[model samples]
Target: AGHSITTIEGLEKDNKLHPVQEAFVKEQAAQCGFCTNGLVMCAVSLLKINPDPDDQEIRDGLQRCLCRCGTQSRAIRAIKRVIG
Candidate 1:
C-alpha cells in the first residue's frame, strides 16, 4: 500500500478544476460514470511518470480499467489533451 494516494475527489481544490478534469470535461470523456474515477486515477498515475505518453502507451497503462460506457478512447484523448 502507498502512504499517499490521490483519488478523483482529491483532484480538485480552491474551486478550480484540475487539468485532468478540465480535459475530461472538454473532451466529454466520461459515460455512465462508474469507471470515470478509476480511469482518471490511472491517467493521473501514468502522467506522473510519463507526461507525454503515446496513445498505445496510454491504452496499455490503463488496460486494467474497464469502462462499460465505451468511453475508453475518449478518456485516452482526454489525458493526451491535458499533457500536451
Candidate 2:
C-alpha cells in the first residue's frame, strides 16, 4: 500500500483553483514564492486536523517553515482565509 501525495500543482482541480490556493492568491501570500508550495502544504495538513486554529496555534504549526522573502504574515492570513 502507498500513501497518497499531493504537490502544490496537485491542488488544482479540473482547471480551477482549490479554495486554499485561491485564498493564498487573494491574500497575496507569496513574495519570492520560493516557500509557497511547502507552506501551502503545511497549512493544508494543519487545517485538516484543526479546522479553526487560533492565531498562536497557526503560528506554532507553521514555525518549521521559513521564508526569506518575508511573507510569513501574509501566509498566516492566507491559511486563516481558507479555514474560514
Candidate 3:
C-alpha cells in the first residue's frame, strides 16, 4: 500500500503542540484522556476538510469520536478556538 498514515504524535513539531492540541489543552477538553487522541485526530481531519466549519459542522465532524467523560462542550469550544 502506498498510503500515508498520520497519528496524533505526528501532529507536533519542534516540541510545539499543534494548534488543535493547544486549543484542546487550553479549553480543558480532555477529561479522562481515553478519548483525547481520537478526538484530536478527528478534529485535525475535520479542519483539513473544512477550515472554517461552523458549530454544527464541527459537531457533525466529531460525531464519530465518542468522549464518554462529558468533555464535548469543552471540545467544541476548543474547536471554535482553533477556528478563530
List TM-scores for all candidates, in order: 0.90, 0.90, 0.95
Residues 1-84 of candidate 1: C-alpha lDDT, one tens digit per residue:
669877788989998888988898999988888888888888888998998999888999889887778999998889989878
Candidate 3 lDDT over residue span 1-84, tens digit each: 899989999999999999999999999999999999999999999999999999899999889987779988898999999999
Q: lDDT values of the candidates?
A: 0.87, 0.86, 0.94
lDDT: which is higher, 1 or 3?
Answer: 3
Encode model 2's per-residue lDDT on 1-84: one tens digit a residue.
699988888888899997777888999987887888888888888888899999998998788887788888998999888877
Give candidate 1's whole-model lDDT: 0.87
Best by TM-score: 3
Candidate 1 TM-score versus the reference: 0.90
Best to worst by TM-score, what's the order? 3, 2, 1
TM-score-better candidate, 1 vs 3: 3
RMSD of each: 1.7, 1.2, 0.9
**Which regions of candidate 3 are displaced past 4 Å?**
none
Q: Stretches of candidate 1 above 4 Å error?
A: none
